[model samples]
Target: MIGQTFNQNRPLSQSLDTQGLKTKTRSFWVPLSIFFVITALSITVLGPQTQSIFDTREHIVQLQQDNRVLVDKKNKLTSIDKSLLTRQARIAVSAIPVESSGLAALATVRNKAFSSNITINQLRVSEGESSEKDAAKEVRLQFEISGSLSDLLKFIDSLSKAAPLLRIASVKMVGDGVTISTDLEMKTFWAELPVSLPPLNTPLNQVNKKDQDLLGQMNNLKAESLGFVAPASASARENPFAPY
Candidate 1:
């Protein structure tokens, strides 16, 4: 009887052991399945979203750089425009008139000669032919003036400060003892009537160093008083429909 009871207890113990193993296995499988599902969701849903966020950030940075470059360019253009409106710029522009004639240049030379106490014996005017290189028409003045050497030198110096800039093409001088007779061939320039100004956005042409130096020299000279007359205003009847 004792032996049979021992055998019965052994079977019960074996059954309990089997049930404990099943419970442990079920707990392990449940946690493992949850971990796999979370990993899959992260790969499928979150991966592309992260990449898109990075791409958007890069685009924003590029746009910021472009905006900065545009701002700098705008500032530079504003500074240049301000410089264009200065007094020196206006004087430089006025040095070359839009339209002029030989008569005005001749008057300037005569005035300078009178100032220097020189006598102009003859005055001849001729028109220069225009070419592709020099689009503006040139006026050539051939004249003879009589004065002392000192007076002649003064007259030439004064010409440089006169308006409607003149170029001494040739000069011949003869002296007897004190008084000298000088023949001069000079040229001045003029644009045709109805001149149009360049557009504001136009780029400036390249200027040579020599030309820049000459302009600087001209700026140092005293301003000549050229009595300019304003053109008469058109009558309202002339263009009744035009804006005031």
Candidate 2:
């Protein structure tokens, strides 16, 4: 009965209608399409430039990993460092011992003269602590030499070249030939400089010996002159040239 009533009330074409319908468009939809188009264009235009920047950054990092500063640049960097730490450490270690080595130095000096066939007379050794202005204690010597000019010259060269260090203060000479007589006053430095020096003509030899023996003599004579009774303390302070 319901099916008959529906068929009667409505036309059969309307009940099964497939007709087109009118539609309304909103303003937001148009703007939204334009926004998506602008977004796509920006990504397309900016993509390569952004990727190029990233690639450049990666190149720099890879180069840094593969490369090192040149030797000249490294030296310059070392020079720019303000500490001078290695130099100061060397000075402190090798330098501090020169103070008490005057006696051994006198022995070595006289030996140099003797080896050169020169005669040393009126040898004298003296030592003094540094004044407030000097910042370094100094040990000094004065003596006379009678020898050929060549021997005298050689002696000077030898002292300047001596290990454990020596410095000349003044020189006086008379006679030009083989019979010349010269007077010299010289200075040396040590961390624990000698107070009073031993007499000259000691048997210390600098030319040949065990390194330890040479150092031992130097150290012993230094201690004797400076009146330092302690050895353990000194041993603890690093040797300046120790395997550097």
Instruction: Report every candidate's CA lDDT.
Output: 0.76, 0.64
Candidate 1: residue pairs that collide: none
**TM per candidate:** 0.52, 0.40
Summed backbone clashes in each candidate are 0, 5
lDDT of 2: 0.64
Error of 1 at 111 (Å): 1.5
Q: Which lDDT tens digits does candidate 1 get at residues 29-57?
A: 97889988888877987888888889999
**CA shift of 164, model 2, Å:** 3.0
TM-score of 2: 0.40
For model 1, the local distance difference test gives: 0.76
For candidate 1, what's the RMSD?
14.6
